[model samples]
Target: MIKLIGVALIAAGFALRVNTLLVVLAAGLATGFAAGFSLNEIMAMIGKYFTDNRAMTLPIVLMLPVVGLLERYGLKERAEVLIRRSKAATAGRVILLYTAVRQISISLGVSIGGHAGAVRPLVAPMAEAAARGRGGELSAASVVSIRAHAAAGENIGNFFGEDIFIAVGAILLMKGFFEAQGMNVSVWAMALWGIPTAFIAFAAMWWRCQMLDRRIERTAADNAKAGGVQ
Candidate 1:
């Protein structure tokens, strides 16, 4: 339907790699107009919503500049250099450590970084350098695998860890849901239970990381064998 033009625009914008903020704004305006809102009414609604949600948006808006400043100052390079100098920093260990960092920071209600804001720019690069340490260049497949693990580490850490923060949305949502179902559940209890789950999740990921290390080694060996045969 023509009413879905806004959705189409959003999809196309993303597919075409347009400016994200502009794409969002355009989608909003188009949707509002398609739904019979006048220009002034839509403008007023946008202004009011923006004012009300500024707190949530502020961090994301400010994050770009801060991340940009750090990148400009060689944060990625510094991370690589530090890890490369550490002989014990294997690819799996590096990712596990990053997962630990992510979980700890998120549990404390501090969001350090994410895949978009951190992984691609910082974590992946540091991991690549660490994994490549004293081993010459890695195969393309090996490099992709390391980056994938870096991204997964961020996801596992943040999702599990944030539930441990008492005031986070998950605790509040669970509390509300339980109350709605005529059951009593306290936020503290919910947070306490989250700790065990987070711990278990961390342990599972740790085991997986160790497995990943073995897999990478096997891949490297096979690649070397193939090259030698050639």
Candidate 2:
């Protein structure tokens, strides 16, 4: 029961909204001491784990500063301008194109976009521009809905596409899990199986994009009517 002080520390840290990485490290140190590990032993264990697993998080940490630099240079504004200048651009069309690009790039193991790296600072603004077009701005509800759809498009594209890449984290995880369960599975086979699923996901989302176009237009019309009546 005394060893559970670590759990309380974790809970308190989160409640206080402390930096998550700091909180976790603090709780782990506390738990190690509680478990009767010496300071040297705890440090050794932490060093070992960090060496083994830091690859997973290091790229994201390194990229954050670069992403911030780009955003500060008006990446989002440029994306909006480019899309708005193209008369053919529409919210649904832009999202659909992005879905295809995302899926293809992920399949090749090229992580070209993420919610933070791409969506917030580029995709979302481009999508909003398309929704607004040359017409009056989209209603608040319409803007939110289009952004949600754009985000979903990115997610669906990534989820299904990465499975097609044998070296992707999810497929490696699946392979490891199955191997642990004493089942021999091939990473290539799993990737092959993901092909049909990827196609199905694209088809389904394409249909949904069509529906999204109609929905955005209808929402705009309703907002216009409400304003006129006022």
Candidate 3:
């Protein structure tokens, strides 16, 4: 029963909305102490874990500084400028392209496609700029719609594309499950099949974005007419 103190700590920390990193570390330490480990042993275990995974986390650590530097120096403005000049590019189209880029990048193990790191600072603002250029002006609702579409694109693309990588955890789990059931499955087969599925999903999402663009344009036109009539 006392062994569950670690889990309890996690629940309490989360419920209290404490700093997540501190909470998790505290929970682990508490759990280790409760489970009969000395403080030194617990500290050693934590160090060992980080050591074992050092290479894996190094890239993430490197990316944080790089992303921060970009934001500090106006990467968002650069992204907006790049998107605004393309006459045929709408908010939805710009984001859709970002979705594709993010998916491909994520499949290769780079995860710069997140909401805070990529979407908000780069993708969303560029999308807003693109839309405002097309329609001459943008309402708050239009801005929200553009950002929402960018977020949705990042989410959907990342969700479906990552599983296609043979070395990804999900495909490995699938391989293990099939083998346990006395059926043979190959990782290569999963990767091969995932390509077409990803393409289909991307096309479907692209079509939906196009529809949203049309709807936003119509709403803008309707609002204009109503204002003129008043």
Candidate 4:
């Protein structure tokens, strides 16, 4: 069916690395046209859909100014200082703890830890600063690596942990899908089983953070020795 034109547009757009918003809009237009809707009618549909969703998003947009104000006053620096002063908290350790906390929070229905909200202004900078403090001094490569790892930890923790919550959309979807196949299952059962999987993922990422810290230390020492020779 020409209805599938939207799907083709999406696939092509992604394969060509088009801007996501643009691609989605284009796909929507194509689908609307294929379904016998005029361009103006399609525009109206888009307007109505956005109007419904916009109310839900107003709170997030409103909070951004508050977060931006905090960043202007040195939120990242404060986070670094707080972590450094705490003996048991390395930057990596702090991020690991945050990963656990963020994941658990998402499972608890607070999905606030995302790129715009948490990663850019707080977690990444704090992790980088922590890495630099403990590893003597970080090179550009090390800084990027530490930032990447911090992001990876957040993503992994959220993805694997959120399924452990009965109220999460994924668990509800799973329940629907299984029941459709005549297999009755409860969301609570699915969530309870997800706990062990979340723990395993957490431990694996924590181990990686430990290894990265060790490697950073070794690299810093090597750089120091090389500098001494010069």
Candidate 5:
């Protein structure tokens, strides 16, 4: 039972808004001690696991500098300019399009879109440009809302779409977990089940995007009215 102290520590640390890395390390040390492991053994286990999964961190390390360079060279401005050229584009429509593309690409096991790599530099700016092209100046709050919607679209698309690829890490993880529990679930079946979930996620996000557009329009109107009153 003392082995579960780690979970309690994690909950308390998060609730208290402690530094995440420190909280996790403290929990790990507490759990190791409770389980009668020496500090050196715990450190070795932690190092081994980190080394085994080190590949996962490589993409972020490689992607950040590349994204930074592109942004420095006007990637965001170009995205905004390109989006503004479309007369029919709205912020909602722009996000909906990116969500669809993200889902489709990730379903094929292509690691294309992410918050830092795509949403921040490309999608958010494009959506904001689309909103501005709608002929009203956006309030600071509206701008923040548009960026939030952009990030949400990426998250929804990635979360639902990755499971559709049978070879993806998430599907494999589920297969391993179920097999350990003696359920004998197949990878193909898990991937198949994800299709309907992906569709549902898309539908829900589509509705939310439409609501975002309406909200933007309302904010614009309110701002216009306030200007007139002053």
Candidate 6:
């Protein structure tokens, strides 16, 4: 039971708003001590786990520099310019389109699109530009709202779409969990069930996107009125 002190530490640390890395490290150390592990043993265990999972962090390490260079070279500006060329583009439509593309691509097991690689540098900027095209200056609140919706599209698309791929980790995890409970659940069945779930998720997000468009329009109208009053 003392080994569970780590869980309590994590909850307390997060509730207190401590630095995440420090909180995790402190929890790990406390847990290791409670479990009767030597400091050296705990350090070795941490090193081994990090080495085993290094592949997960490699993408972030490689992607950040490239993304930074692109942004420095006007990636967001280019995306904005491209989106503005389409007269029919609205902030919601831009997000909805990306959501579709993200869902379809991930369902096929193509691990494309992420908040860091796609949303920040491309989708959010494009959506903001589309909002500006609606014929009024956007308030800071409106810009933040558009960016939040862009992030929501990426998150919803990724979370629901990955389960549709039979080889994805989530499907295999579900299969293993059910088998452990003495229930026979096939990966294919899980993937098949995910189809309806993905469709429902897409439909829900589409409705939210429509609401986002109306919100953008209302913000624009309010800003226009405020300008007239000035």
List RMSD in Å for every model shown. Answer: 5.9, 5.3, 5.7, 5.5, 4.4, 5.2
TM-score of 1: 0.63
Q: Could you give me the TM-score of model 3 versus the true structure? A: 0.63
Q: Rate the local accuracy (lDDT) of all candidates.
A: 0.81, 0.81, 0.78, 0.78, 0.84, 0.83
TM-score of each model, paired residue for residue:
0.63, 0.64, 0.63, 0.67, 0.73, 0.68
Candidate 5 local accuracy as lDDT?
0.84
Better candidate by TM-score, 1 or 5:
5
Best by lDDT: 5
Tens-place lDDT digits, model 2, residues 125-178: 877887787346776777787789889999999998999987666777687668
Candidate 5's C-alpha runs over 4 A off are: 13-29, 32-88, 225-230
Q: Which parts of model 1 have CA positions greater than 4 angstroms off?
A: 1-88, 181-183, 227-230
**Which order, best to worst by lDDT?**
5, 6, 2, 1, 4, 3
Write one digit per residue (lDDT tens) for candidate 3, span 1-230: 98888899899999999999999999999889989999999999999866754545556576788878876898756755765566646877888888887788777765655798778877887777777676657766777778888889999789778877776656766776686589999888987788888888799889978976887787678767777312
- Over 4 Å off in model 6, which ranges? 1-6, 13-88, 179-183, 228-230
Candidate 4 residues lying further than 4 Å off, grouped into runs, are 1-10, 18-88, 228-230
**Candidate 3 backbone overlaps, count:** 0
Give the candidate number with the greatest TM-score: 5
Q: Give per-residue CA lDDT, model 6, range 50-139, as digits (tens).
A: 675554556557677876787789775675575556664789999998888789988987666689878998889888888888856777
Query: Per-prediction count of colliding residue pairs?
Result: 0, 0, 0, 0, 0, 0
